[model samples]
Target: MTAETAPLLELRDVGKDYGSVIALDGISTTVRAGEVTCVLGDNGAGKSTLIKILAGVHRADRGQLLLDGRPADFGSPREALDAGIATVYQDLAMIPLMAIWRNFFLGAEPTRGRGPFRRFDAARAKDVTRRELAAMGIDIRDPDQPVGTLSGGERQSVAIARAVHFGARVLILDEPTSALGVKQAGVVLRYVAQARDRGVGVVLITHNPHHAHPVGDRFLVLNRGRSLGSFPKADVSRDELTRLMAGGAELDQLAHELERPAT
Candidate 1:
């Protein structure tokens, strides 16, 4: 495919195993710039395994991982970050007592001065943090405030903004809205769209089809380490996606089993 049409990241028949336990099997998907691809599955459905593989924490044994249509084998998470794939886990690695700007530039703090005289450029860090958060539609009146003071959704948004600022080509978000309330969850989804609009391909991993359907361009459903299917939004309605995610026949069985007997 041409450069413009090529997916930012592609996985072909990818599979992984822990001894004899297959965690993923023949899984295939693609993440394109300016779009969100949601991976939906219940716990034990291999979602964590998938994230580990994509984040370079583990290598897929049976498939090809292509970046810009070229095969890639990442040796470590650092390698994945260097290659423009950034994964934001549920527990954001921010220091609760640290200032927002300090957390923003955490490990990669900008330095000023020379040799022994060099020190963290606090002014530049604060300015950039404010600008970047504003760009993401996050208004923080005081970036000097402790990050722990921010709400969960705000924390998630800050993580996303940080990824975007650091040049993440493919953003993998692991259940960002899982612990959030209805309103807070909405806040995080908004930033997910913002990232996509900025031409960063986003892979949103979640079990909630409700959250995934609204912002997703495509969906890949997994169950027990296997793919139910990959579908475009046009091909799958929100209700249909919900049904598939809820385990179709199994859900039906559950409902029937829970029904009260007629008097």
Candidate 2:
């Protein structure tokens, strides 16, 4: 990874609004290869809005979206995929009854043969899925197992592997650990690191500072549709991050209000 190169994806002064409601305002950040950029904020902090724009679900109203140092405007999620940007939402879009290997390939299946005789290569799919997951430190007992049979963390890892396998240069994870327990969230965070090590620019969107602190290379804090600013890991601490996310004034006031009830 070139430490000084331009970001793989960047949003410059990007923003979105719906009539009178400003969903996101003056947001800017860079996602560089081989690093995790955590977008942290509480509910209603424009996190979802930011994810939508990055995933190409909505166009930015006020700024430029750059890819590889050139301006890029993705018309749809498919266009974003073609541009090597892949998004993994919390729901995961997986079929519970489908085998893990099948879910891994989902819409883009490996195929072989000519014209009408072409068929999905199940063997290659299973083998590649197992190999990739194992490389990410995930050990699956069997590829034929149903996706629903896997734990939350394992499922997230599979989605990530699929993205990386299909040529995604940048990965956007939307609240990957929101519904997970501590142990499971840790598992997902490890894969986030794995993706970084494998040279994928990762955008981790979540409200939990603890989860972000351990794996993030940089932090971008958002609040009520505005960006506080971007901070590198070395520039900020977990407690400071948590306070910013919760609103420093609000936290301080709450702390004082709850202080011993001073009888």
Alpha-carbon local distance difference test for all models: 0.93, 0.91
What lDDT tens digits, residue by residue, belong to model 1 across residues 1-263?
Answer: 22378898999999999999999999999999998999999989999999999999999999999999999999899999999999888876578899999999987789999989999999999999999999999979799999999988899899999999999999999999999999999999999999999999999999998999999998999999999999988899988887887789989999999999989
What stretches of model 2 exceed 4 Å from their correct place?
A: 1-3
Per-residue CA lDDT of candidate 2, range 1-263, in tens?
46579899888999999899998999998999999999999999999889888888998899999999999998899899889999998985578899999999988889999799999999999999999888888879999999899888888888888888888999999999999999999888988888898899999999999999999988999999999999989999999999999999999999999899757
Candidate 2 TM-score, C-alpha based: 0.95
Model 1 clash pairs are none
Q: Candidate 1, after superposition: displacement of residue 97 in Å?
A: 2.3
Per lDDT, the best of the predicted structures is 1
Please give the lDDT score at residue 59 for candidate 1: 95
TM-score of each: 0.95, 0.95
